[model samples]
Target: MGAARTSDRRRRRAVPWVVLGLWIAVLALTSPFASKLADVQRDRAVDYLPASADSTQVAKIQDRLPGGETTQMVVVYHRDAGLTEADKATAADQIAEIAGSHRLTGEPVGVPSKDGTTLMYPVASNEPGIDEKARDELVNDVRDVARGGDGLNVEVGGEGALATDAAEVYNSLDGPLLYTTVAVVALLLIIIYRSPFLWLVPLFVAGVANYLSMGVAYGLNQWFGTSVSGQSSGIMTILVFGAGTDYALLLVARYREELRRIERPYEAMVAALKGCGPAVLASSGTVAAGLLCLLAADLNSSRGMGPLGTVGVLCALVAMLTLLPAVLVLLGRRVFWPLIPRYGSTPKARRSLFAAMGSSAGRRPRTVLVGGALLLGALALGTLNLPGAIKQEDSFTSKPDAVAAMETLGRAYPERSTQPITVITPADRAETTLADIRGTQGVDSAEQGRTGGGWAEISVIAKDAPQSAGETTTIEDLRDKLDGSYVGGPSAEQIDLKDTNARDRLIVVPIVLVSVLLILIALLRSVVAPLILVAAVVAVWGAALGIGGLVFGPVFGYEGTDPGLGLLSFVFLVALGVDYGIFLMHRMREESLNGAEPVTAALTALRTTGGVIASAGLVLAATFAVLTNMPMVQLVELGFVIAVGVLLDTFLVRTYLVTSASVALRRKVWWPGALSKEPADPVPPKEPERVTAAAH
Candidate 1:
């Protein structure tokens, strides 16, 4: 018997090493693929558009044209007062030099503003074609030679230059985003764990999970042809670290509690897993299911994000559940260092903050519930203040050179658009299409350009400033008036993006709510419980956006909201915010199963799981907040709204409102489930004397 016991211990000791070995092997295999994720990421307008959109059709046909896709740009020469004769001469000379050095669709045409303060040269080339790098190089080369001096400002602005600048910002995100997120999580972990060594364990495991997610994402892109943009990949990384750390915190907290009762390290770890594993699995499953709903979205970016986000969350789940447990067991109680939980040791008695909050909630559930609802409703009204749909030039938090140029053009040519609206039609219908475009009410001019691949391209100028009301109307009119032809350009793409996002919200929102509600029902085994959770998250989402509406323009100085912000934020908040609900509600259900009264169960659950949930929320919110510091306005806005939503859900919604609602509902919170009805007193064991005597 002693020998058998010794063998069991040996086997247990070997398990952790085996798991570690397998992880190393897996990481080694995935590393190469992971490094190539950025290579396959595409950020073009068409890459994000719906396949059925007119802009998408035009872009596709352009790619099949004679020189692939044409790169269009405008070099703006401006002065504070008026362009001097020398400034005009310099602009002309530079334009000639650009013409001499590069192949052009036509001679660089100078369009001077009626005010005489600005002279712009429209340039088009097919040399760079569809090569993103070559296009960026072309734009940079133009900037180099078109230097402005002597009180004159020269700026490069156009579809091609704007795209190049946006690409640069995205390319730079991988490094700083990863680094800052790691730093933020590492710092938060240190504070939460209060152990120098323990924080490193989860942080390292999260990093591994991040690398694994990237590899899987790249594989998705390669094998399934998933569209990955800087935005999606960046979001995937955030989920890896945020959700991974959250799982770690829950497991570690449970393990600490178990260690005080179980003598063996491996046994305590097993006990911890038995206690929290179901909740963690359900939490990650909720997130994965919510994100996967994006598959129903028409937008390519949103749809691709579903899989990439699911990959991140699932990868984090795998690592935290497997790798984290193995490492913790191997390190045993020592991993916790100064605050280590020794076997058979009792923790100091203290009144925790969550206990106090829960006590107050239990005291007046109705008031808390009503007040919280009213507050959330009031905050949601702020959505009315949200700015209009974001403009292309306003997409960046820090203005790029292209944005500056566009601004100059906007001021200089307030009555006319320098940016052309591209129209693609069958070559056989070129003359009729050109004539139709010219007759369009808002068109200032229309000119036929290159013809290839059975199609002809025509560039149309609007009668008003770019992306303005008049310009948008003109685009709509062109699309409606022109038959058997597609009207597209940068502006057209934005219109399609806005419309697609609205459609996706209508379709995807209900699907997400239903998916999440069903999962909650299955996991909690109560309809009312799931409904409460879903509603609470939805409220949090609305309030968060309301907060964004109030601040996005006034505080952040942003001019417009991201088109995808509404749908994406709703998906994330619903999926992730419910995570805390799961942690709290699952614990409450456990207390009820153990025969605690409803109010007692709710308060007890809150007291026990509150600290861990709060920690996880802080970590998640902070990781996303790192995005607010990013360069792109869309990312910043997304990060801000999500972070705000998380905080609200954590402090107000989860701790107070959810607990209060559960308390007020009592056993009905689990209606129709066995717990809904009070269990009858166990027959006192029939023979209590015999049972006690036998035990003694």
Candidate 2:
């Protein structure tokens, strides 16, 4: 039986390499097809906006508008002395000449600082609205011109230009991020295993997973005709590294444990797989399902993020199960090498700190339950007074064009710098009947423009800043009041903007929450588990928001909370927090089924899984912290929230919840119905005996 089992393990270990080879081949075959798929879907979705009545009219208006570039570039000049009239005129001429040479469209509008030490020139793009490539080109052109003159200190800033510059910076940083994460994780694994072959094996599997996941994402994007943003690209980098390392750790740890007891390498590999496979699958399923829930999001960018994240996690799972085991088989005894522990029949110690906590929880169930609940409640209170502020100024570092443009706008035309909110009435309505929409409640001003036909564009400037709670309310009310109102016509048309904060929020939050809940329930197989998990996640989210509000509102002098902060907070909190919960719950169940006392099992699970969770949390936290480097307060807040949330999950939720829940529930911890009969407590596993023998 031992010989047969050893043979079986060898075969199982070989399976992953074969599967990996096959995946490579499949990738090769599919790589050529992606462009074709992209072309077809791109063409189909290309005219989505054109088919709409309002969009068609808007497009026509945009085409005819002078300096009709969708992007605006601002040039800022700062001097020790106040700018002379000659200085302003010279700067204006330089801007105009540059614009003319570049074939740009807008006239230079200059605004001097109140203190007279700073001057800004706002230049609109000359070409009919710029696309991504054109926007990038215009930014570079403006930068080149602004930096060329000898006597002036100037900086160029604009949303379009800045986004372009940021994309470049992100691209440069990506390689370093990937290299650092991979190198650190690989080195850690090497030190843990003390084997060169084993150390590199995980990296190889992760590399395969990364490439395949990217290929899959590209194909999906082509099929869906959606754009992938720089944020998604950054996310992919961390996801690939973190998920890949995590999966490898679970498998390697199990494989080492099995080898000590089983006596044969192949048999040990098979046992490791049989033991750890279900847990990995469960963890990945929960994560992938949570990510897929993003599909219901209203924003195209977020919707794209969902599938991309899901694919990365799923690939990680596959690589762990197949590629990892196969490498173990290929390496055999060499996998552990010079430091291979001696074979032993006895198991390690059963009673651990986790077990003690669990036992205490069982003894004082109300105390454990009530204490945890109160802590979560206190954290959640921070969310109530959360501010909503979503200005683009909060999204990037000071070095970006976007930040520069915002500052210029604030200085030059604070009143007019607010984003225009276009309220569309049906083209079927008579254009001559109604007045412009500028002076409506909560509106600063309104401008009316006519398309070639009956369509009229009403651009409403909000009295409040964009993405503020007040602006959100104002936009919501405007949509309700203007839509379906009969204005000089019997039939009223709908009023809807192509993009608005209210529309995006309503669609994104529910979709993300529902999808995440479904994933949790499916993985846990208990309705209660998902509820608790999500509730804890929500508390973490609220806590982050409250903390951010406190810091930004009083210290930074932010008027209100940024709206995008809410969306970003949800993503990091739910995605990363759920991961820790899944890790804890999985190990607890494993120990329980293996016949350890419920409290002992919980403790064993914690001691074993705690280190891995801590490491993963730090890596994830560091990744999020990178956002703090950006000049934008929004990104700063997001960085802090995610970083703090992960810390809380690792220290508070995982430690307390796992021990208490496991011990209090005892045999019923499996819930629904017991998956395994209660086994008599076996003799505890011994560590010293094996360690002494391995020294031989």
Candidate 3:
């Protein structure tokens, strides 16, 4: 019988190895597709536009036209004081060289400012058409040919150049962002664990999860026609690391506690999983569900982000819960070398930071609650300081050549727009649309550009520079006048984006709230507790944005807020904020179930879980903060707000305010639940044999 039992134990040990082997095979199968994700990412304005928008329609129509999507550029030659004869000759020679080398749509037309300090050649081509690579090459070739000397400055800018520049920035982000995030997470893990071997486990697992997520994201794009953009894909990486590490922290903490009690590593892991698996599952589920709510968004980029983000969270959760546990069980106590959790050994008791915080909150819960509320409210008022919508030229932290050219155009040609407002009309009604476009209030010039496939493309130049208020009005007037014609360009795309995002906020916000609240209610088995969590996260969202308002313009020098910043940040913060809440509340409920008084349960929960929550928050916040170092201003803004919000939620809201509220409310914090009912008779609480350091 003993021999048979030994054989059964040997077979059980092989199970995890088999599971790991399967995971390895799956990753191997998915790796090639993952590498191709960058090739499929589309960042064109039209790609992000709402389907029903005229710009989106225009893009489709244009693609069917002779030129497909036109590649436009402005080659600017500037001599600030005044263009010398030599400079003019140099500019003329470069423009002529460019026109000679490439297929010229029209003779390179020179537009000189009144002061003669700057001269710009308007170059448009359809040779590259809709191929982004071809378009970028054309722009690069043009820049290569256009050279400057004798104090003459030359820059290439326009829609195509802007797109090329943006792509370059995106391409650069994947490597630096991934490395920085891994380093940050590794360093933080080393600090948190204080062990040479332990930190690498979760970090390595997160890296694997990221690799798998990339493969799955690529598959979604190829199989289901899901749109992927740099922004969405970058955020997916962040989620994989941020959320994945958080789950690892909680699991390892619980595993350590169980290691001190259970004889075998596998048994200890099993016990730890049973104790904390539900909370981790629910936390990740809440994040996934909230992200999935983005599918209801009208904007294509926002809508596509839903599936990618969900895949990332779910992938991370699976890797952390399964692979992490398997690896830990296999490695056993040696995984925590130098601080090994020996069987039956206990950690020396000490006054924890959370204990002191909870003790103070317990003393004057109402005052702490009121003070925290007032502080968040005051910070929210900073929203009034936020700047207007960010202009295209202002969307980069460091101005690229294209943006520099546009800025020069803005200054030298303030009276006329450099970019065209594209109008795609049915060939049958082309004449009528042309008449209306010409008659538009701010129109400077209108001309037919390309015609084919029952459609005609007309380029309209506005009196005001691109993205200016007057130019926006002109496009709107053109759209209002021409019934079937589509008005689209960079400026119009912005308008559509802003409108779509606002509409999405209205649609998506409620869905996220309801979905997350329902999930919380189900997990906690109580109404009041879920409501408190929801309300707390909402407040954190506002305070975070308000804090952004205070810093973005006056402090960080950002010109405008991203149109989707508020909505996207809210979704991320609320979902992630509630994550820590779930940990704390779950532990509180556990203690309460074990017969601890309400106040003691809340305080005890804080004392034990506080350090883990803080560490997770730091990891998440640091991972997101990586975005601020990227080149794009929109990304920087989004990263700043989300990173700041996580810190606030982690340190202040989750740690103090929630604790205060719980202390103030007592059993009422869990009203409408069986646990809320006062115990018939008081029972002494059992002494904690192990530190409840895992995320609740």
lDDT of 3: 0.90
lDDT of 1 by residue, 255-280 (tens): 99888877777887888899999999
- Model 2 residue 537 lDDT score: 78
Query: Which candidate leads the pack in lDDT?
Result: 1
Ten contiguous residues minimizing lDDT sum, candidate 2: 486-495
Write the number of the candidate with greater lDDT, choosing between 1 and 2. 1
RMSD of each: 3.0, 6.5, 2.5
State each model's CA lDDT, in order. 0.93, 0.62, 0.90
Q: Please report, as a residue range, the 10-residue window in candidate 3 with the lowest summed lDDT.
A: 687-696
Q: Candidates' TM-scores? A: 0.97, 0.77, 0.97
Q: List candidate 3 segments past 4 Å from native.
A: 681-696
For candidate 3, lDDT tens digit of each residue in 1-696?
678767767876886798799889989999999999999999887898788998899888877777677788999999889998888888888888888888878888788998899999989888887999999999999999987866788999998899899889988889999999999999999999999999999999999999999999999999998899999999999999999999999999999989897777777788899988988998999999999999999999999999999999999999999999988878879989899998878888999998999999999999998899899999889888888888878899998999999999888987889998889889998888888888779999999988899888898999987887888888888888888778888899999998899999999999999999999988999998898889889988888899999999988888898899988998999889998899999999999998999999999999989999999999999999999999998899899989998999999888889998998999998888888898889778876564332311
Off by over 4 Å in 1: 682-696
